[model samples]
Target: MRSTIVRIMRIAGLAAVVGAAVVAAQQAPPALVSEQELLDGLKADGSRWLTFGGDYANQRHSPLTSITPANVNRLVPQWTFQTGTLGNFETTPLLRDNVLYVTGPQNVAWAIDARTGRQIWRYRRELPPNLTACCGLVNRGFGVLGDKLFMTTLDAHLLALDMKTGAIAWDVTLEDYTRGYASTLAPLVVKGKVIVGVAGGEFGIRGFLDAYDAQTGKRAWRFHTIPGPGEPGHNTWSGDSWERGGAGLWVTGAYDPELNLLYYGTGNPGPDYHSDSREGDNLYSCSLVAIDADTGKIRWHYQFTPHDVHDWDATEVPVLADLAINGQPRKVVMFANRNGFYYTLDRTNGKLILAKPFVVTTWARQIDSDGRPHLEPNQMPDEKGEITCPDITGGTNFWPPTYDPSSHLFFVNAREVCAMFYAWKPEYKEGERFTGGAAQRVTGSNQKAIGALRAIDPVTGERRWQFEYLSPSTAGLLSTASGLIFSGDADGNLLALDSRSGTLLWRYQMGATMHGTSPITYMLDGRQHVLVPAGTTLTAWAIPAP
Candidate 1:
């Protein structure tokens, strides 16, 4: 009788302890994505991807070496998540705590379980019938902080969504979409602010950069690309042409925490090809601007094409790195511009270190000491027509490139083609096409449209090696510390190549081109997984579990 009574008392005590533990767990707050995590970027533990470029420097280089060139060929698709949407994907997916946050075309978003490729919640917006998203009906990606995920809409609004429930926390209008203002780039979150920009350069809209408080939807500051009445660059434009100068910011930029500055590439001026109306260098358009993150003050600017008339936006992505020049260490920003020139500039003061043509460019022979292009005569477009190499797409558009620090290589997909450009005086209409020129592909016995993945040395601005694609590939790139690169081609071949030699190591057909999208890698279930978004599908690949 004594033994039975002791056993019953012990069981009751254990039950009480178990119940208390459950209560405590239920009361605990959800894990917050701390500011430090954002700054840490892609950590070695492979826990999270908190930013678009995988880090503030826009390196897009992962340090995870779990899957290298040797085992890369063994990568098999674990599961595929379909978006079930019509348009192609251009957004980079953000991962945190085994969950994937994806933004699809048409302002659609999803929160998915990374382990199972299953959707937890979906959010869709009812947009206006007339969306003046000049480029495409797409979004770049989301920016996260605390418990909120931020995304830009096709109608020019920025939304803060609840990460767990996919519900709206706050909504803020960026600009009037009906008046030729739209946004498509990923929002860059830094310090305590979310930085973003407007898109619609071809529609005669003046562009600007903005920062908003992460907690509230209130804007912190706005930096106009085109200067106002008394500002210094206001005289660059002719007459009231400054109102619709069209230096849109459509691509994301790099940030320097040490300098507290943000670097962004601006777009082309309006009446794109006819230069009669807007004259005299056209101020900040076709240039890169460095701005103070807190105050939105312009620190320095470098114009790639002064008074650009060939429709080269200079809206390429800006990558920051600390490289050695001559014999001394220096900070630099490398850009492969749409004007068919590759440049390495001093990031600290926006001075040109080296500039060289990467393709068959007939517009300019070389860059002068003052960082101005030495123009080749008879290159400007007119009503009759003028033939130019690199065509209208310039060299490469908005596809994100990759920089491998170990190899010191800058990789990009370049087009080898030219076109006959035609120009006319375009009538301006609000929210309508305002470009005064169009490009016709030049196809002849000697002409061809070929693409190649070229590796250029940042120190010398010279070609190190190149891997040619059958056609011009629009895919972005991702590099790993294990000497592997992930890219897709125009023929829908997802590929893995040796970063050092550009040798093909592995390939898979994903049934769609990775147009304007790049793959991201992370650790899941003790193995590194490469997640790719192409067309309407999101496929996760990794080496088979042991």
Candidate 2:
């Protein structure tokens, strides 16, 4: 019969090409978890606790083990709320279902009710009576999606509320808050878009990283980190420093959705002590790029201080795990860098598998085996003064660090201190607002005091343990598989430690000073808590037997 009807049309075209290759390998992208399946999927249910650091590999590690360390000294406090508006509260709250979103000092925003903290809706944000806060009126939190609620405005706008009636659905403005650019980190929604970035790399302003359109606030794509004519790193940058060349993608970026990329992390290159006016090797700022969240492109970049004159702004937050180096299973990313080293990379391309020097570093005398950092021609800062040694706040890490994956340990918060740079000679001015370069501190030097809480080994950077903070930690760190770690202390206490041996165990004190946001754990009804907001309040703790 015509060769059996051509063998049933080639067996129905081979079963439709094996069902479209099994739906493209089941949509690919998502296989990066494994810090013990992200602390057993944050203790398997903690109930809500949505975004910002929590569900983002930012690893503010939660897993709500119901508060351990042998009863966590019976933690108390239960509720506080405050926010009357102050300087360094540093926010970082965002539970869903029971509500709770936060954000204070000027960019204000509330929405409470995470189990009776009250205040159901606030949203202030008038700001701009002069606005030029280099380090204080913090915001660092906000971004919901689904019913809306995204923030970012120290004057750079970005709005979007209405997560059930907070109202204001769309705002947009992203920059030019008089040119000094603002938006204190925290607005990263990926997939549906919304990912923001911009924080005045010390005020020279020129970095970028927008995305918008979580349902039409517009903007779509706009990478930039300093590159202009013909792009592709624009020959690294020399004269106009690619027009102020800072890089400042400010913070918040670590999405993989199975390689859809979006890693981010770039800062420092600005006038921060004048790297001459922006000389070469400035491709993508302090570097860690990766992009392509739909098409912002990039896909690869590592930089980590290439012509950086030390204002160390790799702005932290990179995490993204899956260890097991030599025996295989890689996919890293880790980062402690603020120019004090401790990297890992190769999160699917950016390479540089490791780089040590966790601290006390005298401005790179090493870090090259591909992790490149060799600087040290007197550590730059010419014009007479140079004394760097984990100065400009480095060595002890910054902006939080935590990755426990069943104690593979990373913890962080190291600060041993050292600085005295001096790179003056800029004083520029074309239309006013310039702060590109200027440094001066060199005196009797040394001024030690160290400040510990180490515990690294993110695939062999070493330092497996230590805990000694009484003063230098600028705050931000959290961990939990129940053994605990949560940090904070420029003297305001709020400790915990003992994540398998750096000891300490419990503390509290919070009268004020816990700067950089980091501390969150949850599990509402079944019990467990830990919150920790500091300054303008939010407290929470728990465990009086749950």
Candidate 3:
């Protein structure tokens, strides 16, 4: 009888504890995300990483200095999280309050415990078998605001998922997949609206940037990259060329809150090499368009390639920076373009400040004072192939570069190579690739393609320093105030370098090259952890506790 009484008292005590926990949870207010928090970027507090570029400025510079060059070798792996999927990661993972929100290939997403590397919830999509997403069936990342997360799908849809649970709150179709539309961009959430762009320039689709109401999933506005009838630059394309003029804005762009403008770099025009199919300067394709954030209207645009026959998509990342030039502070946008050019433009109004070649560019001699490319004769693609410097991939591709505002330096992995390009008339089908040309890599014993990590002054468009690799690297970059810059080579090596001198400080073979992936840093358990997503695994490294 005494044993029974003791058991009843023990059960009652357990129930009371459980009930108290429930009451406490209900009374505590949920942590709400604020706009200022996003603007703060990667702070020394090391709490969260909410955006793709780490900030609206698209500066991937972190202020953490706990792990310096002197003790970087002492850092060891804390934990590893694997996707267990087939494809490698091209997406950047986001972190909040000890939980990681990540998007993977084929629209697989997860919210995982940052400390234990265990998944809290996972979201997998039922993708269409006949999906026409060009390049790859991959997602970039997620944008979170106020207990909700946003992601763009391979089937051209934007989905809002609950933060705590991976359940879909709402899904809105951006465009029909059958119409050759796909969205791989990480949605940019600004001013209570989610901003995104479609990727299908090679498939002969007209690309546009769309804004959706974050709460209701209702589309707020759409700004077509190509001008329609009666638009200012409509005549730039002859006849119906503008109908399928392929001005895709595939990559994520930078936002300037003070200017209320969102700047995005556009993709190559369709019939990619057939010059006659689209005549005159394809106004907006292969350009950077600054649009009003509130209303989807183009403020001004600067065309990188006036009438490009090469497949060099201006889809390379655009980084925004404020620089002082000749004793005057100027708001500028920096771009390391794929067409072998490094450009610095006045962001407020699209005006060319400086344009210089970072690689061997054979098609254009130079940019004229009036911002026109002086084309070289006999360089256009035809039935017989023509060799071009910097190849079809240009100097770089969509892999993001980094900027150090303190150093006034922009860092990019540039390719030094050439390719033989061939063109034929392409008959456009509903969901078929519409690129009229293809490029063959020019290679031999003596001829080789190589890559280098280049640091250029944003003000002068001149090389500050460079670190060469055996081959071109598609990896992205990260920098810190600790005088360190993290990068990866094509040979499966994660590298750390001095930010000012470009001297190698440390190296680790991650088994796979970063391959369009970047290393993100944060604080965990009182230690700073560097997280790298290479291949299918996320490896977290930290210094051993003293």
Pairwise lDDT winner, candidates 1 and 3: 1
State residue 338's C-alpha deviation in candidate 1, in Å. Answer: 0.8
Alpha-carbon local distance difference test for all models: 0.86, 0.72, 0.85
- lDDT, residue 288, model 3: 95
Which runs in model 3 stand beyond 4 Å of their true positions? 1-30
| Candidate 3 residue 320 C-alpha distance from true site, Å | 1.0
lDDT value for model 1:
0.86
> Compared with the true structure, what per-residue lDDT tens digits does model 1 show for residues 344-402?
99999998999998887898989999899999988889999999888888788789889
For candidate 3, write residues 39-76 as lDDT tens digits: 67786358678899888888888888898888776666
By TM-score, how accurate is candidate 2? 0.33
Task: Go through the candidates in order and give the clash count of each.
Answer: 0, 8, 0
Tell me the alpha-carbon RMSD of every candidate. 9.5, 21.2, 7.9
In model 1, the Cα lDDT at residue 161 comes to: 83
Candidate 2 clashing pairs, residues 3+ apart or interchain: 29-257, 29-258, 30-258, 35-405, 271-436, 391-418, 396-414, 396-415
lDDT of 2 by residue, 164-193 (tens): 545577898987766677877788786677
